[model samples]
Target chain A: MRNSKMASHLSHFTHKTSFFTSNPRRPSPPCMSVVLSTAPTQSYWASIDAQIDAYLNKSIPIRSPESVFEPMHHLTFAAPRTTAASLCVAACEPAIHLMHAAAYTHEHLPLTDRPRPRPGIQHKYNPNIELLTGDGIIPFGLELLARSLDPARSNPDKILRVIVEITRATGSQGMVDGQYQELGLDQLGSEYDVIEYVCKKKEGELHACGAACGAILGGGAEEEIESLRRFGLYAGMVQGIQGKNKAGFMEEKIEKFKELALKELESLQGKKTELISSLVEPSLAAVQIS
Target chain B: MRNSKMASHLSHFTHKTSFFTSNPRRPSPPCMSVVLSTAPTQSYWASIDAQIDAYLNKSIPIRSPESVFEPMHHLTFAAPRTTAASLCVAACEPAIHLMHAAAYTHEHLPLTDRPRPRPGIQHKYNPNIELLTGDGIIPFGLELLARSLDPARSNPDKILRVIVEITRATGSQGMVDGQYQELGLDQLGSEYDVIEYVCKKKEGELHACGAACGAILGGGAEEEIESLRRFGLYAGMVQGIQGKNKAGFMEEKIEKFKELALKELESLQGKKTELISSLVEPSLAAVQIS
Candidate 1:
């Protein structure tokens, strides 16, 4: 009974076309890549928030035992702006696709991965991050995924596959592995190869994984899934490069990945491909400003 | 390629039964429950270690980017004694079951949950836990579940179902939710109701969830799974009663739960059930001493 209510609540958010109005008047900095497109779409951003609000409302059960859930709520719900999970969910508008995308994005976005904020500050605090504890965001994501879908209709095996994919993408073999590499690198002094390696593993891995999740859950063909996986990987690589000095280089790499992602989307050759293109186009745009 | 190799290595651990010899005549205090049975099983414990070693050896890729995987290696490979996941796997005594069992156990055993050993110590350090960060243990379980059984023959839907079950079991609604109830309670004066709630949520929830995982993964009937889940919950409730002064009550509760669990197992009257019974009996036995 609750499941149907939850689905209905989510359906309302997904179907509201008023949420898709793209804004053309927002200011753009000179370094913004072509992927950014023409003005920032306030509605697209609103859709992201709406999607997250609906996802959380329908997913996380707010009840007693405030201790366990409070941290998660604070970490996810109390955040000021957007989260990777929200971005992932918004990119894939509805239901199963939203969940897999959010889970993948949330799984890889570590609280401890951010740079220390201030000089000479022994304790670096990020309001956005609640704890450095292990995979804190994932349980929230998993809970959302589990609750968001109706068990009677959804395939459990596909759910497990999504879990496996997200876990692997965020696990020791994927994103965490990258964080491990970068942990004390400042003390060791960063080399170009090491920096690139860190960027690929830590930053790029989640984005790539999120993109692939959408592809897989959206019922893309095997070839399409593979292509999106590659697209996500390259796009993530570009997003991970954050230094202001690296803007030119980042733009160059972003364009390369953008072209690659577009080319991959072209392989599907159907309405499904068209829907996926819709997801990828904005994702590419977000990457320019990411 | 690596996937296939991983499957083979795991098979080697599960096939070796030399690890199950029980050692009787081990020292037991007067408070030790009858559920402890006649003897201590040293070999079974060894089997747990061996299984985890095989799992870690096969799953973690130790190559360049030593930074990423090393922390995971240390946390998983260096741990002493048997873990819940391993016990879960060992009880099943099979390769596929081994992975999911171990993974679920490892995910919820948070490092911060420990009570301070010294009265006045400001910082109590546990070497066993290394924060690879972000639901560190889940990936291992997901990997194990993913690698367990064959993709060719198994239903993807069923696999997904297992993932959903396990994730829910460990997520806020299951384990973390319990933890949330317990958090900061020490600061507040411990009320009896609060204590019981905390105990149920923090300690019992995972055990109950673990039992359910094994049941679901082992192919137990819906009734059997419900029975085991109830059995686990009751057993966990009993186990959560920590003070030695409450030992007698705890024993009675444990016995009641064990009987209930056994009755649930009895409901399955077929050859397939025999396999599940093997897994549950020892699990019930372990709960007495848990």
Candidate 2:
């Protein structure tokens, strides 16, 4: 049933870059289709989700310690698909999503005396299990990336670079620092500079890391990697800023960031540029529609 | 003043393996001395602690978002020295301690409703900051290890292998799983089998990872790595079981584990073998003295 659904999507994108087409190591199913720039966002997401599901199933075998693995599996599957995952090459999509899920798990941890009801996975498990599961997901993500290293096809240096990129983006100076700052936001007051700094570190850095890793893994040159890293950073800033405010200043800031994100792709020529642009366009559309 | 203290300790161990001597890449202090097997544990710990303090000071710079980095630094420096840190090669010792500090932070997180006062760094920070600090520390540990990787001196594959070893030992099926099982221990009832399983996964696996990583980084052969891994496992099991109970059965179990741990080292010969045995002897002595 899943294969037939994937087949249907494949048939629609014969001229475009499909996940299976991007990764030649995996045998493409008999009825494979390519993805085009014109493909609906839902269909693109469907392809990514199917691949993520397949990857998770193969990589994380459900075994003993059902208590831990089960929740981790649920959170990974349930995590909302984001531009960060979509911006990656197919090989890195699952690992990117694993990171997203791990961060999401910690972000929603019940640190307060009266915990708010978190959407999706948190409702299913108690707080303690959730905390431990978040801890497990991160190492699991690193292991996935490490396991994916192929010296025959990829450079070990690049893999190490990707690991460093991801770790730095998520480490003390990045996402966690952002979260820590957010906790003190009430005391610091919500000045625009403070908000931007926190958003850039928390949301923008992870997105930047994702794009950078994808570029490194896909064998892009240094300039292309930097461009995509900036693109991800600008696009992520737009995403981070969207719900934080509804004022004119925030709107103008979003438009500027969106333009910057697209400008980063202007120098590059390929199907990937269009695919990457599509990731940002939806957020802009969401803003305009709202 | 610190240098004088280090000099005094260096004078006591002129013939044994010292941390600085193990890694020729690092320049030794002017009055450096080699460590011998007879060097007191306190002197070893002081040397290790001094190195840890220096490493943390160098690696984690105090910068913006002092709220996060400060607590992370505090937790890392304040964490008790363990045999795992001693078992590593000098170059990898700081990274090993970072992993320990990261795990220790999470292990002592205020998960229960009635929070107990934790011994060290926890006393300084609120629960929220402590939680975020733990989140930050893990990625910092990974970054530290990745940054330590130099293709000139270390094989990227070996470094990747060590990363996998540490992540697996600390991931869902390892330390986190053990913590989750401990949470459910009330429901499951603590049979010896259950306790052993938890201890092996939680404590033993981490020690095994430390020994295996040290061996890999130190260029040990496969047989030697396996032997050290088993040695760490048995030794860690004794450490885990030591405080759980004082019953005769528990003592018998500790003795058996200690013997097995010593037996694993019998095939190996060198200063390292003596160094490795010293890691376990202190625990045994504590048990006997009590």
Candidate 3:
């Protein structure tokens, strides 16, 4: 099934849903006749339904506001309660250190900066320079979030820091702490995927445990919902920024900004007046001429 | 990578690692040279240390409770009022339905009658069975958790009825929502694996929203955890009963049950020597054995 999929994708474009010529003499696959004649629409629809079904059924509560992260909440609490107490007296810090390192280096990994590994990480997106701090002094991005959320702190400056931290974690330069994600996914896949998928779980956790923790973490469900949209936007933006597809990139954020602008304009009487002015001005000019 | 892997698995153990090996005359994969030239144990340790160093210095948290989701809690409650009550009337039922479907289906996916698709859902574990309800009234296996928690009436018979429902979710004639599992490292070759990577997301209306919803459906965090574990275990057991590896079947749920059981055991111990043999035994066994 896997082997045939790639060829089928190509053939689908050429044959308009038929993979092989219907002629008996054609050098097609043994079962190609059956597949071409009967399977195209069914398989196509099946695949679409599979993905949709996965989304509708299997994906976890990513954007939900209330009780969204409850499953993850159990997992997070499962985080060795002794983690805080055992921090100093442990050589197991190597594993913990590895987790932190991976968290800082990889994307969607869970690690804090209090246990910084070394001084710096990598260079990417010359657009901004972000480095890794081995220890978690920044501690679970607390320091970073603080830098951003604090009124006294500078937005662009702190965002710049977050930018660097984020880049480090996302790109190859960062380490990914997947064990936690494994805990979240019930240890479903490769350690690598654990952290990658942790993105989904972390999103769940924040929504589950709200308190000063929630206040600090912002596990509010609506915000999580926004995050769902935000992630799609962020990924698109990152891809575009990577110069993967300039058109896709430009339209992505631009369209989002345009939407916000339009919404704002609709809400404001002044903006409405300005828009109507342009439309009504020609009539006014004609009336003056008359 | 995938080709080599699938070939190796489908073939035999003798050809396993060498599946990726190059012809002696052809350029050998880097791994082959290491296979022949064993490194000094000290240097192996050194290299591991270096890798650890490199890995640690680069880690960051992106998706843990500490990273993505929890930080947004403060912002959720600012606009506490739902302005349009009429909107609630029109939207609430569907929203609840979506939640119920998502939560119930997600919960149901782990039942014995696993593939609860109806209206295109396996719905209940049995082949051709359709998924139609929200309250988890389906399957005898999952009904155990439901009836265990249903506040309307918690009679033993009701609980037993619920268990009976849950049993319907499991077994050969039930849901069989499909599955996913990772092989252990020693037992692994090349990349890690999904011993049987069933896609639950493609199964039914159960998204992760159900994982957390299990807590509510089961009536609390503690019970919800049990509900999830019981469901995962029962589904896995069904898969095994269907003739997959018995050990593999228990693998996913063992840790899950252990974790929950241990926590329960801990709380059960409380501050006293109240080692209520029934509750304390599990915890004591876990403490001693684990």
- The model with the greatest TM-score is 2
Q: Give a tens-digit lDDT track for model 3, residues A1-290.
A: 12133233323323321122334354332111111222333342244333322321221233321121222222222232211111111111112222233233322212121222234433221100111111111122221122222222212322222222222232222212222333352455664344334432232122111111211121223443243223322332222223323434345544553344233324433211121111112222222100
- In the order shown, the candidates' DockQ scores are 0.26, 0.47, 0.01
**RMSD to the hidden true structure, all candidates:** 10.0, 7.1, 27.9
Q: Could you tell me which 10 consecutive residues in candidate 3 chain B have the lowest summed lDDT? A: B82-91
Q: Give the candidate order by descending lDDT.
A: 2, 1, 3
lDDT of 1 by residue, B1-290 (tens): 15576445434433332111223343211110111222234444454556556656656556545644444544444333322243244222222232222332333333322322334332211222234432345555555664454432354444445555555655556654544445443344545455566556544555556555555654556775576566566555555654334545455555665566566656545322222233334543232221
Which wins on lDDT, candidate 1 or candidate 3? 1
Query: For every model in order, what is the iRMS?
Result: 6.5, 2.1, 23.7
Query: Which ranges of candidate 1 are over 4 A from the true structure?
Result: A9-42, A78-129, A132-136, A146-157, A185-195, A242-290, B1-49, B78-87, B90-129, B147-149, B178-183, B186-196, B236-290
Where does candidate 3 stray beyond 4 Å? Answer: A13-290, B1-39, B42-46, B52-56, B59-290
Per-residue error at A241 for model 1, in Å?
Answer: 2.4
Q: Which scores greater on DockQ, model 1 or model 2?
A: 2
Across B93-170, the per-residue lDDT of candidate 2 in tens digits comes to 566677777777766776543356555534567667777787778877776666664333446777677788878888
For B1-290, candidate 3 gives per-residue lDDT tens digits of 12233222223212212212334454321111121113433342234234322321222112333322121111111112211110111101112222222223433222222222234333222110111111111111121122122122223322222222222222111222221112121232322122322222111112122222322222234543344334333333322323335445545544543344335434423211111111212333222210
Model 1 chain A lDDT-worst window of ten: A27-36
